[model samples]
Target: MKRLHAPAICSWGHFYIGVRNLMKNPGTGKYAASLTCTLLLAGMACVALGTFFYFYRVKPAATAGVLNNIDWGWELSYHLPYVLISMGAFSCLFSLVLRKIDFSGYERPDVWLLSLIFITLLFYSISSQIRFLDNDEYEHLHNAWMMKEHTIPFFSLHFKHSPLLEWITVFFMSLQNPSTLIIRTMRLFIFLLSCGSLCVIYLIARNVFNSYRTALVSVWIVLCNFVWMEKSPEIRPDNLMVFFCLLAFLALIRFHETQRSRYIFLFVLGSLLSFLGKQNAAIFIFSIGLVVFRHVLGSLRTRRFGIILITTGITITALAVLMIPHDIILDIGFKHLIPNDNKFWPTRFLYKILEKNPEIFLLFVAQIFLFKKIKTSHPIFKEYILSVSIVALAFLFLMNRPWMQEMIVMTVFMTLLAADALSRLFRKTGVIICTLILLAMAIPANRRLIKKYIVKKTMTRDLITTETILKISGKNDLVFDSYGKPIFRHHPLEPRYLMYFPEKFSRLELLEKSRTKFLIKDSYYPRLPQKTIHWFENNFRKTKKDPNIYVRDMAGRK
Candidate 1:
């Protein structure tokens, strides 16, 4: 017994020593393996939690936008399975692609990434909790449902706008459950795709720069504490447009690097899809041109191949121009260029100024400092200068007005630059020091804000529950609420602004066209001007007690 115990003890001691040695001196391969396993476990946990939440909460209430009081041929039970399938399939697709990414040296992303992710999750959580019942999302869903059920989306199927988003909306509406959780889950799905695109951008940048730190910085910037990430979960076209635009950007960058014709086609296709996503895609088209200006300027300087690339672009532009009808070409002028002063000009300009003043000033300062450093140190300084110049010029020209829509796009570009600036500045000052300062600033800033307003005024007090809106909105009802409007309304049935398109014509006309029956409004939200309140009150029957909600008569006779 003593002899056997000695051999066993020696073997066990050797095994423990071997394990300790592996842990102590993990080579690159071993480190990579460990990182991979850790990530897999983390991802599995996230999926499990997200999935459980989605099924138990999201699936039941998502159909509030489209299926509230409206019965479709599909069984309510089928939706959970469909959503599960969609989510599962999407996750598998992501896993396949993400598994290929070798996150070898990048260990800890700094506070910015963590902060951005935290802010994004919080913002989306807040927006998702509001539900889309009385939001613009409901109207969009209503229109999409109309398209599927009646063969027309925005009035009789003959509407001019492309049905790209509408088609997707209708597809989801077909699997209706009227659950807030479901609607949020759907938006979350898209947001995750956008996150994936950001990861792709990171990989591309890493490959091009051959610097893990730079790539991580770029990812942090892309997913920075920007407004859009928080707003993306609210059922809007911007999220979809951003995803497509980023895809196009990534493809174009790939093409620029590798000179691959397939990548060029992908760029064009993505740009096209982006255009189909939102009317503001013209900005993306313009951005693409600026990127191509890289080639033009290069050709001009080096005489590598002058005018040939420009000519090809012109040919493609001509083809695209030919696709649009003469009527639309004419309409663009009357509709957009010659804005009615009373209706759009003053408000738009003021909005632009308010939205851009701080960002523009800050970015200008950053550009001045960053350009000097970038010129001296960056490997791609030449390209950076050219790209920065293009972006600056576009920013100058396109920030023509301060509409909320434009502000979002502007924020997207500026936030990235800000992130870049912060990353560079912090690197120069030491990561640990900068991180401590940032945390110090963030905690106090958040605390001060919470104390000064959030707690004192009970601002979040009006953060209405989905149950409230559900009680107010019925089938065929139209909700008229802005993006930041109070949560509680007549019933938790109407889609708010974030859930719907921000366009004036699109929301009202599309609702009427879809034969919507009820309308709800909250007067407490100060964003609603007196004129807007009067208009809603004029159209719908006033509630006896609450000025906040206006109810529309279903029989078309208020």
Candidate 2:
């Protein structure tokens, strides 16, 4: 008989009322709010001072005009301090605002945040697609062209790294009309792989943390990282390798969750694919194998443990046998694992790490405050830390090349840990703060990237200049230059010879005696001997309008 009225939904009204009540209270709630504000302000001040010291005192002194010759008294004194202060202030304010909002009740906000991240990263990647390729990218593209033209057999580059990336480039180049579009098309494909890697990172974080919010926050942190942003969209094997490496980690996580033999097989498959993408992926593959081995040992009492071991053994052995001929099995040993004088010093590598990703460095400092929480949280957390440390140490002691790119896998691990630390320590507020801090730190690097790659347009200039020179030169004529080797290799107007400026100038007479016609010299080179410069100036007429190029026709003159 009684008509029951369901309560009308008034979420916003309730929130308003709660805020008013807290404002009115003079007891613990108000005090707690005031204390939080004080702590936030204090933290911001400390960040401002630390950043100031780092840039003004530490950085300039360390580099000492080697790479940074900017007037620090004016630039660092004004612009940098202003930026750092603004960033610190903005982060604190943003965190305060985020602390009031309850994101847990709605799924839409999380989806919106994740979509924003994806879009931002996609835009950056698209911008980078048209930008110039890196030196390593150029080398890979040249090698791919060599294979496509039958100048070199397939899998020639596979001995050093892997041929899969080059083969893919060749396939895409085959679709396009002009060979120059090969780099652009390959960049687009690499962009997709980068997106895949981002997705895998999200999935792994979600699985490990069991929270979509945390995972989304993790992805945001990673997207804000300059190294990830810079390296992801480039035409290089590292992007493909990183994607498969993340996929392998995802499979490992799934195996841990479900105790499934299929997931183990998937892990093995992913690891092999990653190795095929780049030999450096062996570091990640071995780390995952260790995790799997640990899992197997832990589950020794279970009935399926033996089956797991047998399947894993079979899969690994099969992969090893298949990779032996390709040289992937011994690649790491031959390249990085052997100790050499060129090995990067651990201290210097650590400094470079801080120099490259200051945001990660900041978050690492934040992680120190949350060390107790992280230590008590999960076994997998310790495993990640240990694995990253091991890989980083290995890189420091053994790797001859620049270890920055190789540390990307370690960056992922650090990002996950940083995300987890933020979540545990400060919840939603920390997420907002950390994200803003990272973006702020990335400002200088992002500006430099845009200036160098997008605004300057040297790559396009070089490409057009090379194409023009190729059109004028005869088929049998040798084109000599230090730069644009990739362009020459791909287009092949004539057989191009790369000559080092100072190092090979002693043999300039030999090049002059040969059938070399056009000398495409970049203006960036040091001044040659006045006699040789006068000879080049007098003998060969400039062929192109590009001021950076010095094209001289050898046959028309002396």
Candidate 3:
């Protein structure tokens, strides 16, 4: 029995000749015909099944905005495909394990770990495309669209959130006018930018821990952190802010390693970008300042380092003053830099960690106790993350709420600390404990990814209402949109905003009296008050074409 040659196995002749031999058997003729017929039937059944669902079952549900309800046909057509794809994924993973791939050319386990990270995040990036604007992205996307149309942030629009992320979104959006593809495309782009941040995390940890395994663990911990899972995938400014902070942190690390004056310039640029993303990122700058101060004090014997730091800071400050527009400066002074709630935010940082990422919280506690015991390649590494984490937590007290959204800061550095702690325990205490901890992170993540993405898919965003409104209303019509339903129309006045207004006056009368053209009432969680909802029901006409749309009834109004 001769073993098959590699070329003989792979060549086209192998498949062609095997088929010829099978046909020559004469015994398999009827069976092969039946198999081919079965294959044909399977292929044809796809179309038959789709037609049946479309004509009879799924289409019965009126498509006003999103399908009014999810039915059996809807589940089969939408979800079943993802289920099949997931099955294929598991089969591939099983095959990878069974057939040990070559690793001799690969130098270390970092490659394996990095590969795992890549695949996991790639899944997330792709999976994110299926989701809607689940968070503040409703307003953010609208603001970006407005910015694309040359509306100035903070001055022209009532937007106080970060500007750079919106500007970045504008850059992508310029390519195409996607009525609703905006969320999916922007989310994908954000996920890509977030990947760069992950790289920085891995590199920073690798330098600090002096071990690729620990660094990889750090990256994975951040990825699996419940906060990260919720936030990182969204089209949000905070993701960009975190990315920019990591960039600045990376620059600082490089400057320390090489003692180059150029890295200082890069650090300045990253901090500026971070600030442009959000002013609350001041904590990141504070951490960078702490590192800079340490560098200055550490090298006090040599005045050269101190001189470089001062010169760079002055230069960057001057450049910022010159380059920033007058409007932006005014905005920074009026809203961003100066105004605060004066009221302290709910002290929920501990609770958020407990509810969302308990694994990280527990490991963080362990790291605090075992700080003296953990070994790192760089001595400053210990001080670097610690100072940053402390400043971030302290800054949270200073920065509770700028607007509707609460601040989530310093999570990246905290995750690194937690991962390093877990690595230390694994090295000393053993693998079993670490494995359980990993499971705690991985299992929930698995269920979430499977259920949300594969099971039902997040369809909270759509253009049905927007298209409907555009069809019905005049160009100047005011809209009551909560989730950016009407892109080109006026900014959707929120029932929440009637509530979200800082003033004591009730703007609820605007809904009753103001010539509000349309109200989008849908599953995207429009914050309509009971009275406003009743007003819409009585005063506005709900079209059968789109039940989600409430048109202004000027004819019926006295």
Candidate 4:
């Protein structure tokens, strides 16, 4: 046992205390390093929690099959509160992480704003499902099924054009069953793609504006809209194409910065993918051409111009040859929409775009000022501004018509621009004050969308009918929906190709051999053929109606 003097013991104890003190009060360098670590941990925690909640609660509940015996109307009623709570929690966590982030020399406000926009977009795209409660979405699904089952889209929304959308549908159907709910869930993939594209947008805006606020403003413009958020989950190829177009735009901007062949290749590939995704994607090509003409022409002297022109011409030739194969062109008539359908399909070019999306035109007028501000920092934004402006103006001027179908795209752009405008206003002023203003506008908009679509129309009634039909008819058997109602025709039955063509098939044979049921379209029996009506009257017995769908047993046995 080594014995120490009291003085030696006391000196050793002091040394230990000093070491503890140094560890506790480690200087500014240590403080910053600690702060960074804390922020990282907090961000990770929030993300983990969000993922847990999303998988366990949001995704499952939102994508829950209609067959579940829950009151979907009531369940849907909880969506807003649920989303708000999750978003609020995420915001708080993210904000805390922001606090620890050392803005330091990289005080690029664009970085911060872009981050916020990116997160906002991710939130909506991830959380929301498609708002395609209407018949059009079903039509898209029908096209997808046809693609999967080896059928083709005959007409509508590029209808009667090559079965292009079939390829998109098949892509989705391959991932999951051909259930409407599953199709809706696939929107998450689009949402994720949109987020990835926003990264490019952020980079472009950051370089152009050199201001985080400007970059963020562009992002804000993309988010905070019912149009994009509500429709994120739709099975439409438009959303997918939009994200791809954004990616192409980003690549173009990168090419401007780096002047690299690789980026140009990316730009071309992305643009081509966008073009192939939907008809509107062709517009993106025109916009890209306009941007190229603006930039490349400015720097070209006689010699440079010749070289650039030659290179451009060769590129164009190659792309054209690649895209427009001779056989494919012959198979797909190069002529504009089926001849002599002017009543349903107008040939007036401007009228076609305008008529399909008049609101887009109005939104352009409204967003003009914001575009002006954005152009101050980014000259390229002017090209997009001009492109969209020219398209809208030309459509209005030429056809003097409205493009009602284009509302979805127009609304998406408008809402994005509006959100940006609003975000800028808030940043310039304060969030507390701006939020009140947004609320004032939001209330009316919410009421209009909810009352007009979600409430008064009562579209989910169709879901109930489908469920009832499946229950009565059994999942294994083929059933005829006699409920000749347009909703039935427009929705569940229409897409499934389950509608009975009166003259083509033997109804008696179908009913007697397989356990099939006739779902009377009690609402629209007037439109049903007399032969179909007589057959239903003779063979089936009406089982029930109200609080449930009416089912009739074939052969008059019931």
Against the unseen true structure, what C-alpha lDDT does each candidate score?
0.47, 0.57, 0.60, 0.47
Q: Write the per-residue lDDT of candidate 2 for residues 1-558, one digit (tens) a residue.
A: 011111111322343354344434423343335434543554366345535554555322212232123342533332233333333443354335335533443243353454356335534543544455565676677667667777667864325567779889778778765445565456656765666676777777777776666677677767766567566767777778888878877876777677799988998898888888888777776765676577767779976877788788889999888867746445543455656654555566567657766656676657756665554224564475557546654665566655456666777777876776655543445446645544564455457555654454324444445555555555445555554443433332222333334443455565556555666666523455665566667766554344434555446345
Once fitted onto the true fold, the runs of candidate 1 whose alpha carbons sit more than 4 angstroms away are 1-103, 107-136, 151-162, 178-182, 207-209, 291-294, 297-326, 330-334, 342-364, 368-402, 415-421, 437-519, 524-558
What is the TM-score of each predicted model, taking all chains together? 0.62, 0.65, 0.71, 0.58
- Best-performing candidate as measured by TM-score: 3
| lDDT of candidate 4 over 523-557, digit per residue (tens) | 34445566756755666655453233344544334
Tell me the deviation in Å of residue 234 in model 2: 2.0
Residue 10's lDDT within candidate 4 is 43
Candidate number that wins on TM-score, 3 or 4? 3
Query: Who is ahead in lDDT, 1 or 3?
Result: 3
For residue 189, what is the lDDT in candidate 3? Answer: 68
User: Total clashing residue pairs per candidate?
Assistant: 38, 0, 0, 26
Q: What is the C-alpha RMSD of each candidate to the true structure, in Å?
A: 10.6, 14.2, 10.6, 12.1
Candidate 2: regions farther than 4 A off: 1-112, 115-119, 157-159, 293-333, 336-352, 362-372, 375-378, 381-386, 425-453, 456-458, 473-477, 483-514, 523-541, 550-552, 555-558
Candidates by TM-score, descending order: 3, 2, 1, 4
Clashes of 3: 0
What's the C-alpha lDDT at position 249 in model 1? 64
